[model samples]
Target: MEHPVLIAIRRAAFTPLGWFAPGPADHAPENAKFLILIGNTGPEMFRRFARESGVATKLDAWTREAVSGLAADLGATAVYPFDTDPPWPFLSWARRGGAGHVSPLGLNIHSVYGLWHAYRAALLFPVVFDLTPPSPGSHPCETCVGRPCLSACPVGAFDGAGYDVQACAKHLAREEGQACMARGCLARHACPVGQGFAYAPAQASYHMRAFLGARQEE
Candidate 1:
């Protein structure tokens, strides 16, 4: 008998409120029977959930376990992670080697959340779905010559190598980041896509403070 577990996992992971809030792309699993969407809850949330689950010792391990469990239940062949180093093989292929460009909407062109979206877990099935991967030829950033995101930073937190987590946090800790603290995040909002995904200023400041450990001025 095929694994009924795979179906159960699919239902849980792809549901409207499932881990992956919105589905990304559809892929064919060589052995699995279903597909699961792992939602983005940010890095901290991922760690907390993993620790509580007790199946993983590290963030990556915990995520893998979560997706695997879902796939196993659904009789799927494999589970995949969307974020972190080196994207999934199929996703990479679909991206047509343009993985270096950050997505504008915080979601991958194939996904609704863009770069802001992340996968805490994944589940794959053996069955084939009528899903069509996004065209790897389309480049969203091609027309974005100004790169507002790079300029919107009050402290130039993004140094092209990666975000200066310390610098960003420190600035947000003080009154200088008041604008962002009162209204909404600047850098995230600067992106052309996923305007709705912008974090509220207070929320951004809270994250900045946590990352930088910067003390607020009295």
Candidate 2:
């Protein structure tokens, strides 16, 4: 049966990607009935909402709070992509069902949004809802003529092996990488699908700066 909470959750501006029951013998809260994978349109949409709300927190913190607020209204709980204390396995979750695939870039590529989207939150709810696995949307990587995402990185951050975090950060710190740091990853932009959903240049730049700045502080 369709749950009113799910409908309400969608109306609150989150896409429900996957639905599944609590695992066997799990010590999860008795009230938690299902795990719901949720995502937003993109970081730009989220940032706009944050700006309109007049929040003063950093973007990541602000986004988590905003999604949590929506979950609270539905008597559910929201956890973010950034959570790591008891680190959430969001990529694994997304790969398992109707969500999407782990791309050559070592990122989850949604069928509709490809690599251009952001997964803002994961929700746990106390209500029953659809248990059928969602259609794992058409994979763009499967039919691409040359798979440009594999070789588009100037620094080779993505390759036959996988994504190199340190290599990517080091490159972004250099003058040559300024373009990507200002407009988002070149490898990500090379994907054929979901160009329409790509993050705006300003939004991409904001995130790129934050990413590079965070690594330097470490």
Candidate 3:
């Protein structure tokens, strides 16, 4: 049976990975038994939600407000993406809980949303409930004989060594990267699972632009 709190969480944002597990006590309430990891399923819904919210101008701020507001309504504490005080290990936590796995491309591959998704917020709950853990059933990349994702990158960003962040950014800055920028990461779309939830072109472009812009600022 689904926990009532989990249902309420879905009303605001998609809970891609959720489980009954205790995290660092200082970051969570006493005896926290449930962790609901929220994220954007696709760009369209998130953009619309932000527009309707009429909150902060920046995307990060809007998401923080939305997630925090939801948490407040439930009387639960909210952990944000930018929380670096204790430095939450979101990717590691997602993998350990079976909600996501490390793909050959060095990206997190979700069972239902694949790699074309983003982590937004996390909610810790005190009460435990009968629920199924989010598992990437059968590990999509494990059974595959040919790893197309590794080869799909135009700049070889996913070469065996690991993802080359600098190389990818350079390529995206050039005209050649427009295709990827418009349609999302090629390696991500090459995944056999969760193609249905792939981001629309506009959404992909928005994210790609944001990604490059952030890198430039650094």
User: Best candidate per lDDT, number?
Assistant: 2
Best by TM-score: 3
Q: What TM-score does each of the candidates earn?
A: 0.50, 0.86, 0.87
> On TM-score, who's better, 1 or 2?
2
State model 2's lDDT: 0.75
Any idea how many clashes model 1 has? 27
Which stretches of model 3 miss by more than 4 angstroms? 23-31, 53-56
**TM-score computed on alpha carbons, candidate 1:** 0.50
For each candidate in turn, give its C-alpha RMSD to the true structure in angstroms.
Answer: 8.6, 2.7, 2.6
Model 3: how far is 13 from its true place, Å? 3.4
Ranking 2 against 3 by TM-score, winner: 3
lDDT of 3 by residue, 1-218 (tens): 66677777777656646554766742554556767777777664566665675323556777777778888887767676677887777776676567678788877787777787767777776766567776657678888678888888998999755889999999999999989888888988888877887887766777788889888998
Alpha-carbon lDDT, every model: 0.47, 0.75, 0.74
